[model samples]
Target: MNVLSVALSVLETALVFVVMVSVLVAAHEYGHYIFARLFGMGAEEFCIGVGVRPLLTWGRRRYRLALSESERAALPMAEGALDAGEPPRELNEETRFTVRAWPIGGFVRIKGMVPQEDGSEVRVPGGFYSKAPWKRLVVLFGGPLFSVLAGVLILFFLYWAVGATRPAGTSIEGIVRGGPAQAAGLLPGDRLTAIDGQPVLEFYDVVSRVRDQAGRDLQVRYVRQGVERETRLQPKLAELPDAVMGSDHLPTGEMRRQAKIGAAFGLVHVALGPVGALAEAVSRPQQAVVGMIAIFERKVKVEDSVGGPIALATMTDAAVRQGILTLIEWAGILSISVGIFNLLPVLGVLDGGQMVTALIEMLRGGRRLSYKVQNAMAAVGFSMIVLIVIGVFFVDIKRLVMPSRPMPEFVPIEAPKR
Candidate 1:
């Protein structure tokens, strides 16, 4: 692609990434808003994207049709008053809505999310921290739950559309030299009808049966050229050097274990389509969460797993080139990542911080911390998060500017003219 085209592609990829992140964020905030509404607490404002004022409204009515001369003139003065802690004749509708200059993410605002110290009280009813602990947990849990649900839905659709792999025909697509299947005289296109006298419908069934066998014998049924045959295949439990978890991969041990099946795709397994899809969807989020936890625990190094905007855009671009189904899988994985990360209960910058605080409260017996304290902590957390984001942005930019080295050149000899 040309420079402009490449830039556009990158921009589009970034936008998709932002949207995925923002949607998950919106779901999390919506959780808080819904619960706030349910608890009879006031929810002052909700919005989908960040930066710049798109339109202004109060309740369900559009208050400011456009940024008029009158409205513009009133903006500075109104903002000044609001900043000064002077309440407007009524809560300014404009204050309740905003469109920021940057549209990277979205947020929700509750009137009294922070607790006040010095016995000072919140006059506004809908602050987040003011709600019951259970309510707080619901709000806190919402983001991850939304993300998981989103994954499930995506998986369901993907599965329903594509179906899952099963072991009906035992055919070795390619066997490693000296590997178990190869040693058993198994050849490509061999139909595996059974394992250990048990009829197997899916490739996964054979894999599952074989995995626990470490050193046990596998009785396989095969049909080759219209001939039925059985063979005793001893599965050699080889200590393969990390065949999975690539340098850029950060899957947990659990994830690795679940995906370690080697079975041939066949017709009988394909018949159980819905079941396969459902299983795929449900397992996705769990995989993501475990991956994240593994990364966090230093079991997986950040350098081995981390990717900034550039890396992600590059991956997305690659996916786009590969085809739609591949792209959907990548999108699903990224969505799950965004969802899982945002639920990390650290109370400040991301939605998870408040959740962590709420969880802490749940574990410890005490009146909730003052809103002021919570807010201050949140602010600190938010500031730190902003710094990290800035750092990532620079890292991404650095990769763009610092061109990669050209591959080493090798000279080739010219053959004699014939």
Candidate 2:
């Protein structure tokens, strides 16, 4: 592609990423806002994005009510001021609803949720800190919970509308040129019937048989254009680089050997019923949480597994190219990931950290930590989070700028002369 095309693609990808992140963050913060309001906690500001000044503000009272004639006279009158003897217009109490310039995420600032630097207690009614510990815990938990819930709903809609991809039978989608499968005359759309006299039930079965029989000739039976065919081929031991292996612990120069037939395929899409869709939606979050735990446990390499915003944009671009369904599915996955990340107990500025602090306060019989101590701890936590983000950003930039070596091309076998 030309430079302009590349630039446009990047811009589009970035726009999509920003919009998705904004929506997800808004949903998350809305959860906090809603729950806080439910518990009568005062929310001073609910806004999308983080910056010193907001570009736009809503929910501000448009008119002053119950103004005396003297006070009204002092105020500048509009083009259509109240007529003689007209009572002042009544407006609901204002909450600062804003959209800030930076679009990297958002927050709902609940009053008295955290101590200010001035060390003054919020003794006002409906202050977050003045609430019961359990209520505070619920308020903190709301953000992540809402994120997960949004993911689940997205998954359900995608499944219901576009169906879920699943293995139906053994069918090849594409073959890598010069690979064993291509050498054996396996073509796209061919359905594998059996291997080594063993019937193939699904695509995974064919993969397993090929892997198990690596370096050994295998009698493969397949159907193409309603005709049965057989071919004998040996699977190759392909060297997979770290990018392909997807393991962080693997040294940069290291490569892992894997049995390969050099074929690419996917399962058929099966339309799901409402129940099935709901089940799939529920399972996605569970799977994401489990995968995150695996990453934390070192079962998955951090470099290979964890991704920052740049990585997400790249992935989103690829998904968009695939199709709308795929993009929606990716969005759901990302939402779940964000939810789980926020619930990790390490960062004091995050929901999990707030919960931990609240729990400690509860254990201490309602005695709260001093503002100075809390602020110091929060600063430390925020610094840690920033450092981690910077590290991940660098990693993402490196990965993007230094492209990994491409997979070895398959060389198609030459046809014998007649």
Candidate 3:
């Protein structure tokens, strides 16, 4: 593609990525808003982006509706004066709904979440801090819970519309040129029936056997054009790219060595009924959560396994090229991943961190932690999150700018003439 075309494509992809992210964020924040409202913790403001000024607004304290700059400034100023103990101009009952210029993420502001150090308290009814710990816990859990539910719903719709994709058998779909499989004369239509005389039930069985015998010759038996054929090939040690590992961490600069035959194959899609679709949808998120836990436990390397926003956008672009079904499935996966990550009980400004603070207060028999200590914890958490985002961006840039080395080829041994 030309420079202009490439630029446009990148911009388009970025816009789509931003829209998808905004939807996910909105879903999460809406969960908190709904639950807060349900429990009488009134939301002061519900916004779908972050900025000093909103581009559009609804509900109470509305602005930018063909109003002049001075007029717009007067609204917030009046509210500020009222907040400063001045006489109320009018009692505003509606919660502000805003759409900011920056469409990155969103937030829902609950009333009286913070404690006043001067021994003063918010006299407003249904303040967040006025609720019991259990109520607060439910509110805190709502965001992640909604994210997970969104993922499941996406999957259900995808399965109902398209189908549930799963492994069918051990048929080879494609082979990497100059790789072991191609060199071994394994054609695309070939089906692996056995390996070293061991029956191959599925594609994974063949992969498992090959992974265990790197650099060693192995007998492969397959059906080609309805004829049983035998040949010998060795799995080569390849320095695979860290992106393949699908972790969230940055690349370690050290390549991961893995055994590979350089062939790609996967399951076929089967149309599902409503019940089957629901089951598949539920199971998929559970598997994603388990996989994420594996990544966190260091059982998997982040660079090789995890992907950040760039990777996700790239994947989404690829899915768009493939079809809408693939894109929907990817969206579901992304939602589930975000949901699980947000629920990690770490010392940060995340939902889990807030939940942890509430839990501590509960354990202390309703005694709250000092604001100073909470602020320190929040600061540390924010710093850690910032560092992680930087690392992910670095890895993403490196992957885009510097491609990995080409895969090494292997020469196959000729089969004896029949």
Candidate 4:
């Protein structure tokens, strides 16, 4: 490929990675928002990104009627104020959505989720801690749950619209323009059954038959939409890239003359019924869990198996080159991974650790940790997250610099004097 093509490919890879990450993150945040709303632990703000200042801000800042008269006076009031011992003039809005100045990242601020929650929570009636411990557990679980569900839905769609690949005895995936296949009235989705009156079971059968019969008109029999048909085609002799020496290395700059219909043979999509699709889709989460276990058990080397954003871009680029179905499969797997990662129990900032706290509070008969302790955990958790990100980036860079499978060094050989 030329330099321009390489640049374009890299651009496309970055775009796909950004889009995939954005969608999954949105799903996760929306999950938390919805569950908080459901349990009356109303959120204070929902912003696409945390920024220095908001680009556009709307919605009223409703004053909590439960706050003391003096506290109400000190608070900045929007809309209007209420008289002493009088009710609020307008209904309170639980949350206000904002578009921030930053173009990337997102955050949802749940009410009374701060370190000073105890002191400030009096301003709001249904603070997060005010809810039952079980309710808190459910709220914490919501984000990961949504991410996994998104993966399941993607898998289901793929199964319903594009079934798994069938390599052997596959149908014609595409017809080459202005080539023999097009000239002979051959179209995509046609299943090759025979060539020149000889039974053709695999791709090799067609290759073997046509490779030696160039320039000779041969009977090509195929099944199209359940109807058997026949056509004749004269295979053209074309010089194509044919690589050999395939033991961990392939020789470059090699070409061979072979017969060609000028078409690509690939997997055929056989869509499944709704029931079957749904069944296959839901199984993905379990498979993902098993894989995670394998990684943790040291059966899979961390360096070989795990990577950060850079590695993600590289993998995404490779998947894009593979085919549409392969890319879709990668997406489904990635969505599931996002859900799984959030549920890691090691970090206080993650959903799993928060759920553990909720469970512990419930077991301790409603007693909760002090704000100071919670703040410490939050600080440590955030610091740990930052360190982890840095570590993963370093690993990705190292892997890129020193690839596990080194590229073969080729010694160019001048063409022998003919």
Output the number of the TM-score-best candidate.
Answer: 3
| TM-scores for every candidate against the unseen true structure | 0.63, 0.74, 0.76, 0.63
The 0-to-1 C-alpha lDDT of every candidate, in the order given, reads 0.59, 0.74, 0.73, 0.70
In model 3, the runs with Cα more than 4 Å from the true position are 1-8, 59-92, 119-124, 176-185, 204-219, 231-262, 307-309, 404-418
lDDT at position 296, candidate 2? 66
lDDT of 4 at 315: 83
* lDDT tens per residue, model 4, 98-187: 767543456668766654655564344456766678888898889899889988898899988876543446477666666787788777
Candidate 3 global lDDT: 0.73
Worst 10-residue lDDT window, candidate 4: 244-253
Q: How many clashing pairs does model 4 include?
A: 0
Candidate 2 local lDDT, 314-338, one digit each (tens): 8999987888788888888888888
TM-score of 1: 0.63
